[model samples]
Target: DGVEDDAMIQHAQVFGKPRTPDGRVLERALSARSSKSGKAYREVVKLIIRPPRAEYDVKKLGPTPFTYVRRFRGGKQTVMRTEFAVVNQRQDVELKCSQWKPVGAHLHELPCVLYLHGNASCRLEALQVLKVVLELGCTLCCVDMAGSGLSEGEFVSLGHFEKFDAEAVLHELRSGGRSNGKVALWGRSMGAATALMCTAKLDPLVSCVIADSAFASLPMLVHDLLDEKVGSVLVDACVEINQCVGCS
Candidate 1:
């Protein structure tokens, strides 16, 4: 049993190293030590990989009416709504997307603002700002990130994998001529981090990025959670285990 635990630690060492924004590897906090017991480590890893899924009644936000009226810039304006799907080529997941545009406005005429929802939230979360965006006269688009909403996926990777999902949506918008070539990203919490990560790869194409309440780092977030629940004594051990299991 000792040998098996050691083997798992060695295996995790191969995947736990974090990378800097420039792609440089950062020193691991617990590289030279292993947790005293693997039970807690395993539990933490399980929680990270399979977080609770956020399920809701799609019909409540549904049928995506053909058009909606909103008071924009002191006057009433009619906005057209369209629903569609985009395929995340990286994961082969279909992301459900919704777009709102000013009536009679062509896609090429207005800037597009893509909204990313927080953890445990779906595209419907974007409804909170629908009126504001409409008043700004920008085209608004929102998609259910894989695993979070009506999108296809079994788990959420915070930002690691969701970044690719965002990329796929951007690609669809650009290639499908869905926007005016100027796109902005707005996200909250986990979605905020996803926007930051996704924007790093497509800096030139993005006109602006607004990240709201993003965590400092994944490991730190996990450590804080562990510290709050189990105690600081197990924080390092749990985080170390998290990285080794490729859930970093």
Candidate 2:
């Protein structure tokens, strides 16, 4: 019985058990492993303990409505095809967007949000997320991050070249009179990082930003993805590519 108990305790060390005694055994085993692989274990511990960065101001944008379409072309209304642009603007060309209007008292003078999506995602994906923002009495303008939805463009650029397209859309929003100098930029994943980098160049008219799941740096993202796919040796290659062409 005593020998069996010792064996059970050793088994509990690496793989945790549900019960308290088994958990204690697992803790001991972990401590032993940590001691055996001190440096490697410490690296993992640092990764876990790393503090969250102060990136964006998180606010509920509100609930939203949708108008789906077969394609992005505009000019004539057709079945299931809908367009979203500033309701009261002239100078700016109407943008092809998947929009969600919040259901509530309108904040006529408040700012609107321009949402950008991640790789392989489209404006349509913003429906649910925009709805939440609308519920907060904020209007949402989810743009197709060029090449992903109805918007035009050939490459993704991982946000490098893509940033230009986003800037153009914002410029149109502001100049077209659809925007009254009060606009916010919201992005997720790659789009979120793009929004952050864009603030460096955009007009102060962009009052606030909301970036979710953004990486600290562009090259870092590429390195991590490549490491996961082809191992760390490719990290140097990705970094070199990033330096040459500026991609993430």
Candidate 3:
């Protein structure tokens, strides 16, 4: 009975069960499985932590709705399409983006800065960033990663598949002609990993990558999460589940 109790507690802790992402409590847990459960146990653990429904429209955030489409695909026959409605939009001939230029901007092409947000987040989350671009005399384009915000997806794979999603945005910005033949990528949390992974693949893709609050390694983060919490029996299962979810 105690073992079952521990497993339930561990599962809830990792998956943000009982309480929702917004800090609301629902109080929930999956069926407990012992370390002896083998492969079946891992599968069950993996199945329990589904990504929350984080879909949101930027149009609803403000009155003036400016829409731009960013499309990509992943998994099996899954299409992730996003339309961002910003408080401001500058459809430069260089690319299809929500570009906000500095005050007194007379040029069509400006230094473009792409913003990437974290998990359970959307492009609208970059409100502060958009403002900074105005001060820097630059244009900002926020990206909505798959399975989050307006992007189409049932779940998020952390940074694993999101790497591809980030790269796609890189090419997307260059669809027409580049202002100066370079772009800067700035991302937070999971979005940071996506940004770093993209830079790793193609160093010249972006002028520079700014990653905020990104983990050094995913496994270490998982281990730390379970420290002093879950029992040894449930630790392996929980970590495996986390790896699957994170690595996607």
Candidate 4:
């Protein structure tokens, strides 16, 4: 048993180490595959690659964009819970959000669509559906997640951190005594994944979901997005790099 593991470790090391190119030596390392490991070592090899930064300016629509609205409060999130484990205690404030209603719209009666923006997007994206929502005689709501739009954060955690954000928003909606539990979700790209993830976590409250262009997997998304810029080999490298080192 040890002999086989020893062989896998040896093979992994061959690719893990920098081989001086004698042409033949470099070829062997690239072709190298560890027994049972199946390029999980390749996951490690992806670290050196630099990922692109996701950037965009928060929308500056104007002062007091809507009339019917409620402000948010600030507080640390210590007992923050998820479907899995409770994370370590950290200072966190509830996500800032706004709920808009037509003059005639009444709570526990008017239907609403919670809009979740895509990666690198802000709550202003709700405007994209505002017109249709009004036409259908429903209200619109959206929130700013940490690190995107007007939310506070140094970096985006993709959906890992956002799944909780979605949950918090739903809790806010239901607890406010505003929604009659008749709510639907609309998300695009990263938002789409968040919508699906949230619904999987809470399907009863989510009457419907509209997700556009959601990626099957984050790593495959990285590979496909980079495939045109780099060939398949470089794409694999970038994918493995992103996989090993969690990047967006």
TM-scores for all candidates: the values are 0.77, 0.57, 0.61, 0.60
After superposing candidate 2 on the true structure, give the runs of residues whose Cα lies further than 4 Å from its correct spot: 1-95, 102-110
- Look at candidate 4 and give me any clashing residue pairs: 46-241
Q: Is candidate 1 or candidate 3 better by lDDT?
A: 1
Could you say which candidate leads in lDDT? 1
Let me know the TM-score candidate 4 reaches against the reference structure: 0.60
lDDT per residue (tens digit) for residues 1-248 in model 1: 45544554444444445544432232233432354534665445445544566677766554544455555446456667788899888778899888888778898778889999988789888888887887787889998998778888765677777888889888877778888888889999888988998888645578899899988677788776676665665566545544544445
lDDT of 3 by residue, 12-36 (tens): 4553333246422322112335335
**Selected candidate, larger TM-score, 1 vs 2:** 1
Whole-model Cα lDDT per candidate? 0.72, 0.50, 0.54, 0.55
User: What lDDT is obtained when candidate 1 is compared to the true structure?
Assistant: 0.72
What is the alpha-carbon lDDT of model 2 when measured against the actual structure?
A: 0.50
State the lDDT at 198 in candidate 1.
87
Order of models, best TM-score first: 1, 3, 4, 2
TM-score of 1: 0.77
Best by TM-score: 1
lDDT-sorted candidate list, best first: 1, 4, 3, 2
